[model samples]
Target: MIKLKGIVAAVATVSALGSSAVFAQDVEKVIEARQSFMQLYSFNLGLVGEMAKGNTEYDPEIAASAAQNLLALAKMNNSQMWPEGSSKADAGLDEMTRALPEMWSTFPKVLEKQDALTSALENFATVAGKDLDSLRGGMKAVGDGCKGCHTDFRAKKEEG
Candidate 1:
């Protein structure tokens, strides 16, 4: 009976460890998805930014498409990508993500930031394809919105 009890205890411990390993993998996947989402944002923003900078010829159609894409992305429900234990402060996440702990600790502040970005994107979409001057003006608000959130919630990249 004692031997059987010991075996049962060992199995429970192993089972717990296995579940932890799975949880860690899940967190990693969530982080990857979040990074991918950011990459998409960067890609679409770059399309408009390059044109606004005069580095790329301002194609109205492309500008409108990219602006609309930004608005669509801003409206996406991506809460799952921000699971609680996935910040840079968490174990094994420090190098994988630049998300500050305050992003979670500050609660609705993040939502406010997101809303600000959404509003900027909505306005930008309306003016982006109108002309070069309008795109430049709209870009300023969009850039400010992104910077506001990053300043408060994202950690600076290490200069390795």
Candidate 2:
């Protein structure tokens, strides 16, 4: 009976370890997904930013498309990708993510920032296709919305 009880205990321990490993993998996937999402934002924003800066020719159609894409991405429901244990402060995540713990701890403040970005994107989309001057006029608010969130919720990149 004692041997049987010891075997059951060992099985439980193994099961617990297996679950922990799975959880860690899930967190890693979430972090990767989050990074990919941010990259998409950067790609779309860069399209409009370059035109606004006159570094790229301001093609109205492309500007409109990129602005629309940015708005669409901003409106996506990506809550699952930001699960609580996925911040850089969590074990094994420091090297994989730059998300600050304050993002979760500060709660609805992040949501407010997201709303601000969405609002800016909505306005930018309206003017982005019109002309270079219109795009330039609306760009600062959109950029500020992004910067505000990053300033509060993201950690600085490590200097390596």
lDDT of candidate 2 vs native? 0.95
Q: Candidate 1, residue 58: CA error in Å? A: 0.6
User: What's the distance in Å from true for residue 25, model 2?
Assistant: 1.3
Tens digit of lDDT per residue, candidate 1, span 60-147? 9999999999999999999999989889999878998999999999998999999999999999999999999999999988998889
- Where model 1 places Cα greater than 4 Å from the true spot, the runs are 1-13
RMSD for all candidates, in order, please.
2.1, 2.0
Worst 10-residue stretch by lDDT in candidate 1?
84-93
Candidate with best lDDT: 2
Q: TM-score of every model?
A: 0.91, 0.91
Which lDDT value does model 1 have at 103?
A: 95
Mark the regions of model 2 whose C-alpha exceeds 4 Å error after superposition: 1-13
Q: Assess candidate 2 and give its TM-score to the true structure.
A: 0.91
| Per-residue accuracy of model 2 over 1-160 as CA lDDT, tens digit each | 9999999999999999999899999888888898999999999999999998889999999999999999999999999999998888998889999999999998989999999999999999999999999999999999999999999999999998
